[model samples]
Target: MDKFVTRAKKRVGGQSKKDECQRENLQKKPRSEVLKEEFQEDEEVNQFPQPVPWQKIEAEGLDCDYSLLFSKKEADTFFTQLEEEVVYFTGDQTKVQVYGKTYSVPRKQATYGDEGLMYSFSGVHLSARPWTATLEIIRDAVTKATGHTFNFVLINRYKDGHDHMGEHRDDERELDPSCPIASVSLGAARDFVFRHKDARSGQNRRQIDPVKLELAHGSLLLMNSPTNTYWYHSLPTRKKIKSPRINLTFRRIVKQRQRNAIKPS
Candidate 1:
């Protein structure tokens, strides 16, 4: 009995020594390092900033979904990378026509997509540039989150509050009405306003109020169908904002040959 007790005590001592050695090794690491290791382990168990939920923004003739697609840390990383890598149109190519007159777009813009894709708006035609590594990564994430595929993207860079988008409908002939446009915003937060098509015509047979949404950094706004069919949206100028904002509107553009069969908007 004594021998068995002695063996048990030895086993206990050995385990205690092993535990003490492990504590000493941990102590050898800097406190910050130790804490970071602990936090990392916890992070593996429980991811930080759990997936953000999508919010519905519905109104008369409006259907949209809004959500912060990425955490602030993720968004900051993307914004910095995009600012360095995105190439914008320059010179006369940047000019757009409105009301029979041409004016330089207030913001820098670029388009990237599959081969042979073209987007025309405000009398400006933009042929798609090949997708960049950063843009592909963004597109994959957006597709995974939204469950929608896009063949084209229009990247508009607002170089401060002065750069704004005029009120317009995205019901262009090349767009596929069956697909929703995923608009991803990075950097400065800005208000996106929407007005009903009939209201804009000064014929208010039905009292429809305008819809407004604040597009935040790393945010995603899905403009679903029928919403674009009845409403127009714009990012008006906010002169007080000095920081830059980048918006990527992902779309599935029907090839030119298929456009003839598309329904009119």
Candidate 2:
């Protein structure tokens, strides 16, 4: 036991000396040189494709910033990687309750984020899995392009045109209202529609026209503030599209403690 303790002490002492040497070397460099080296190191690790010019679409209560984040070759590679890496919910977990009626979702879905983060809507709760390698790379690229940080990502895979998303607002209580949701699309072009809250069927419905957009492969859409507050968006079905589509919606979720603090007693 004494021999073991002595060996362990020597090992720790050696490691400490090595760390001190590294610190001394770093301190010897000029401040500007040290900073430049650190910056270069960060760049080496954070290399990502540059984002193209973005176009803004504005309306009475909607604001969308669209850009093609990846070229055709890059998008094709990402699409294949995502299809192999993401594992979607199956069977009963894929069903959601709407108006007290349960129905299987048309598209497959998955969630990834920081541990313990969760998102709930349509009477369904989705617990986040740990971020995968491909997802982290994609998330980093989105953040680089949008300058917005996200802790959670919800993935939806549409097998073909028959798969669709119904109109709904993402103003869930757990979502951060101050942050914009960044949506990245891979594979297949589809139409995205946004309807005003007052335009939906009802006695007080207005004549506001729904807004439409064509989301192409490798596109990024930033839905900024006030949009979710008054508009509902959906990917309606088109019978002719045969290719698959994968969408990653990166979001900033309020931490659990913050949500609890804001809740009513």
Query: Model 1 over residues 60-132: C-alpha lDDT tens digits?
Result: 8799999988777767767876887788999877998788998988899999999988888776778899987
lDDT per residue as tens, model 2, 192-239: 999999999899999999999999998999999999999999999999
Candidate 2 off by > 4 Å: 1-52, 257-265
- Looking at model 1, residue 210 earns an lDDT score of 91
**TM-scores, one per candidate:** 0.77, 0.80
Q: For every model in order, what is the number of clashing pairs?
A: 0, 0
* Top candidate when judged by TM-score against the true structure: 2
Query: Which residue pairs in model 2 clash with each other?
Result: none
Write down the lDDT of every candidate, Cα atoms only: 0.81, 0.83
